[model samples]
Target: MTMATVRRISECFVKPLHDLSQEAKQPIYFSPFELLFLNANYSQKGLLFAKPTPTENQDFSISTFLDDLRGSLSATLDHFYPLAARLATRKQENPPSYVVYIDPENCQGVKFVHATVDATVEDIIASKDVHILVHSFFDLNNAINHDGHTLPLLSIQVTELTDGIFIGGSVNHLLADGTSFWHFMATWSEIFRSNERDGYSISRPPIFKKWVLEGSDPIINLPYTHEEQFIERFESPKVRERFFHFSSASVAKLKARANAECNTNKISSLQAVSAFIWKCVTRVRRQPNKSETICRLVVSNRSRVNPPMTENYFGNPIQSVSATTTVEELMVHGLGWAALKLHEAIKSHDDTAVKKLVESWLRNPIVYKLSGLFHPNLVHFGSSPRFDMYGCEFGLGKALAARSGFVNKADGKMTMYPGREGGGSMDVEVCLLPVYMMELERDEEFICALESN
Candidate 1:
């Protein structure tokens, strides 16, 4: 297979078409939950391989397609204006603070890049080194969320393939989580599909109000004296990323078996799958029975908050909840027992728990670091299978596959996406040491669970 080469065609910024100069430009303060992502960026890329219709193909042109995408994205930005805004820092403040707000007077629009790949879509999808190849599809590969002050908070790249197109988006994690990221992508696709028609309105316009815990300071102050202190970079170790598919049937069986063993129906499919992965990872690492392992799950606080923030509430309203157990307990307790531990951790993080986490962060601000989150003994689960990843159709058919960027690549980092077949299926993207990945692929128990039913 020939190595895919991505050539940059053009680069520009896309600003909102609707003017908001008259509106009050209040900065949307980042909550403690959102501030946790100050050091990371969320990057995802989707592949669309559906062939165009005969009539459409006759007149299809890459130039025209890109024009439509740009126009629709401009319209979508009218609602999600924060994406075009810059992260501003008040260095003169008592302890220094950061806020995201659009300066109508001088808006730094979202960075847009147009590129072309010199290989077929199949070459990319079937490549053994796909994880390494996908890094070229996204922009801001080396930037963190803190760089948003000088860089665009959101960067999008449209790469055309011989048989398909790849759309990749990189957004500051502090500006949006997996939910908000997909929300913007879905809305942009919807607007693009409605471009030829009239009287089209956004079904879900984002709510951009800053969510603050009652009685907590709206402005979160950092403990750093210089902006340089916020810029911490790490060169991740060599690892391999592989996708594990769990069909709906297999997932259901896992869930059923877990509930049967636990003698309770409260075990969700996510918990069951998480438990299975956690145990498999622990076993593959060959940890001692007395060693402790941790599984950190990223939980959304949108509905868990006091007032229950709307699903459209933009920005990161997520918190990480972990379930820890010794290797012996996790492996010996069986899948049901392991799942129950995850289920309890998720269920116990209620409104009060969310508030308590915020209060604790206020007293002591600690930015997330790869060293603290990702490790050999820790499995950090990010993203979600509930996101409508396959539904991001921009006049083309549904996506053929989804892949993440180079950012956040570390050992034991797993991201979950809804399977292409849908119907409760999940695609677990796992990054691990090369030796561990080789062991995981050869693990009989893990292979049987995925192939069963």
Candidate 2:
């Protein structure tokens, strides 16, 4: 049972690109979350401050204690490197990396919370235990939280008062996919706690070369339009990471119905949720003579699908697979029709096919650009929260709630997880269109009532 008492900054780290000037800092694949948070503070890559767990023998200033902690932590690293990588502007082979600033003048030190380890877990797990509402480690005055955005603020408060340690960081989708980032955090914990070694044994090196994913395609020569310019300039449009909660039972019932109705194709809870969203959205949006509409559903390029992307594969391996239909077609056919469309996008394993499908828009500069801008009514639903929360003990009891932030963007996407042990029920806390959430919440209530029976 080991932990520190501090508020750590995840974003403040920066790795510098050699042979590339500061002008070329941003990479072409910049998304809305990356553009905003990165721009918020380039001077300090990220922020971190910690207070020593008060000891019976002695009390010390936060600054003095942090110095002791930093020395101990830094001693184990292979070499200090910046956490921020993937600059579109810098086309280079070698680069310098950076960690959060340590200058006392750079930011304020961590403030002490009144509670001690003496309190019960339930009592200390209270939101008031951590200073989430106050000044953010990564400049809250300059930052903003939206009802929509893929990159939201996160904090891991490790209090000296108890064996528990807070574990989380606001993740902008651009930095690293869930797979890579979580692995990094978990390893960091192992090193800090083991006290046996500076870092972990048999650790794999991180690859910061994100753009290399595209390879040398002749497609780079393609032309673009002004509309595309706006999209690229604005960043990818997708769901903001606001909470969208549905009951465990409603999702299960919907999945059962979806399976029975679409016997031709097996649909998971994901497909059913997508169908539900499409019907609910199309109903309210269809004004008078609205023609065909497009809904971009983000599919995680994971092994669950055919020719799956390896769990270790990082970067934006995800692609937007579209479901297009006329207003009449969607309204008349109901969930079965939409489920069929969704089912196709997720099925079958073929790297060439997935690459081709993604490249169709990705190669087109205009579409790629506009896809980032006006992805009107974009819906994101996929597998995440990967049930990894249960493993992030850090000496604390299981987290009562675990969620990632989406920088307040638009075109809502939401992911739902298994409810309390994959019990034919689902545990959902994700971003969605508030309008749809209201309707979905009602249905969840009904499902809950039925399940209680």
Candidate 3:
């Protein structure tokens, strides 16, 4: 397949239609969870294929469609004002700190770009080099979270395809996680759809108030002298990413097998699937020098906290916990044993554990960087299958497929999304060294597990 050329047609900043100056504006400090993601950005793209409407004979005007999207996005920004706000630094304090606040007087709106791709949606999606082609659909591909001080906290790119459209979004990880990101996207679509019909009302309005951990200072300081020091950028080695689909029946079979082997029903489908991937990758990458392997699971603390945060809370509240084992033990013990290890690791990270992590980070601020987080023997699982990704629908209809940007692309990085078919199905997007990926694709045991019973 040939490379898809994305030509920029226009670009502008989209601000809220309503005046934010009428309301109180205060700087919202970052929670410990938010602080950890100061070096990363979450970028994703959703493809929407055109569907025939009742008036199929009428010509579809791209200009009209762009106008509706811009108008709805502007109105949606009224509720999610933080996305339009810029990250500010407190230099006068004893130790300089970072805060995200909406400057009503000088609001820097979110960046919006209009572009056209030379390829069709089907061609791009079906291409074997899709991992490289999808990067053009997003903005801020090189900008990290700290760049938000000067750059827009959120950037969106709408690319027109030959047969459909691609809506891509890139938000600072410090501002929101996958849950909050999709929440904003769904709301934007809701408002857009409402414009076509009747009344405009969002089901869930975002709560911008920061969540403070117990016994922790609301204002957290960073050790860096300048904001530039916070930026840690590195080009990752060439890696291939492939999507592996696990049907509901296959997942059920794996879950049952794990439970039967462990003599306990506590093993979850996620754990079982995670164990399967970990084993496959470990077997392929196992070296005599490296005997240990670790699987880091990204856990959400929204419902795990003491009083539990609402689903509408708009910020990052996630933590990563690891399940470690020697290669010998992992390989000899089999999938059930590996899954139980993951289950125990996840179970142990309760409310108390969450608090402890926050306190530890407070004492010693450690920003998560790609270099420090990844290793040859590590499998970093990010994102959740529970997020309502396919539910994001504008007037165009539900998304045909979901793709991510250049951020967080590293060997051993695995992102999970709900399969397009839903019903307990999962799509695991795996990134690995080309050699390991090739070996994984050829692994009969791993491939066999994906088949529905």
Which candidate leads in TM-score?
Answer: 1
> What is candidate 3's local distance difference test score?
0.81
Task: Name the top lDDT candidate.
Answer: 1
Q: In what order do the candidates fall by TM-score, top score first?
A: 1, 3, 2
Assess the local accuracy of residue 452 in candidate 3 as a C-alpha lDDT between 0 and 100.
69
lDDT of the candidates, in the order given: 0.83, 0.41, 0.81
Q: Return the lDDT, model 1, position 292.
A: 90
Q: Which stretches of candidate 3 lie over 4 Å from their true place?
A: 21-24, 51-59, 93-105, 129-131, 196-199
Error of 2 at 381 (Å): 2.7
Candidate 2 vs. true structure, TM-score? 0.58
Cα RMSDs of all predictions?
1.9, 9.7, 2.2
What local lDDT does model 2 show for residue 9?
A: 29
TM of each candidate vs. truth:
0.95, 0.58, 0.94
Single out the weakest 10-residue window by summed lDDT for candidate 3: 96-105
lDDT of 2: 0.41
